[model samples]
Target: MSMDAPTFRVGVVVERRPSKSPWVDHAWRIVAIIPEAIGTEPGHVLGHDGEAVLLYAGARSVEFHRVETGNYRDNLTSGSPGLWVTLALTDEEPGIRLISVTADPAEGESLTEIGDLMVEIAPMPPEIAERLAAFVETHHVERVFTKRKRQ
Candidate 1:
């Protein structure tokens, strides 16, 4: 996607398991107007600033949730009272399209390719969401350090 400010609602999804349930659930949502990036990178560094999403079941209402790309280790060290990973972002769509990590659709699925970045969405609070949206709105990505040379 382009670097310009996003005009559509960004949907954030996170992987979760209910306290009393065994199966995992990707239950989180951060519907906001902001800029998001998709590129090649080892692992993923979810947020631009310190802001991100924290997708759990009942901590907050759906309107306040968010998600970004990250791993388990990131969650433990996130420093937030209850740190969570914000995996991926997408425009408003129906029936958990390819963007929905829980949907677990196959490769070449409907979603656009995000290069080496695996979808690692997480959930967050409203305060953090505002910070993230602002950061993403103005940040410029550098690819010189990310390029691999052909031998």
Candidate 2:
């Protein structure tokens, strides 16, 4: 029940979308993630892990969502569209960082942004949040949840 356990290799990306879809569209890729080196911005380096990624393109930025994580499907299906993003890294691990990017949207997108980004490694009622935490733990990415408001 420790809160700081490492789990998945999480990361984030910034993509731009020309139009808005009724659903959060997986259209773009990771612009960056917390790199494995010092002085590097958290969640800013792309292609750290050799895994496939699915990104959703929005009006201003892109949301990089990983499909490899088993819990992704569950969280993505939940009605809650907003989620938190974090970076997970262990004390001993190096050159290996996990970035936690929620399956939610951000602000300024008018119809997209939803709620506040909650960052905690615990079981949340929403499968997506749990999935996000699991991914962070597995990859050791410390995450920061950003809350969104409805327009």
Candidate 3:
């Protein structure tokens, strides 16, 4: 929440829809990544209008690091950059849990190695893009590539 810090908080919204799957009653997916969810509590149900349930899953921190600027730059520059959200669910649980929100594509993709968690890609909001771009502009260093000598 600090204006000058490398970290900021965002709201995670999830849509829970009744499922036709024989084993599961509902299916959930991230519907939005709100720039600021300062006052909302996690797991609060926003609305349910017969078909889908909208829940303010929680607020999560998207942090920036100098060393990861290159990755951030790559993410921001990509034609379709996204903010990755990771949600967790257990067999006995009724709703999914917000595990994390990340701007690094690779780091987020790596999280898919765990099959149980729901990993989704959401379009990066302008607010987040601005901050990410600023961080990259300030800290990203272009590493020079050198051809290897055939010894």
Best by TM-score: 3
Over 59-120, each residue of candidate 3 has an lDDT whose tens digit, in order, gives 88888877788888889889878999999885544478888999998899999999888899
**Clashes in model 3: which pairs?**
none
lDDT of each: 0.31, 0.35, 0.85
Q: Model 1: which ten-residue window has the lowest total lDDT? A: 57-66
Find the candidate with the highest lDDT and give its number: 3
How well does candidate 3 score on lDDT at residue 28?
88
TM-score of 1: 0.19
lDDT of 2 by residue, 29-119 (tens): 3343322243445333234233333232111222334432334433445554343443232333122233344443332132223343223
As for TM-score, the candidate ahead, 2 or 3, is 3
Please identify model 3 stretches exceeding 4 Å from their true place. Answer: 1-5, 91-94, 147-151
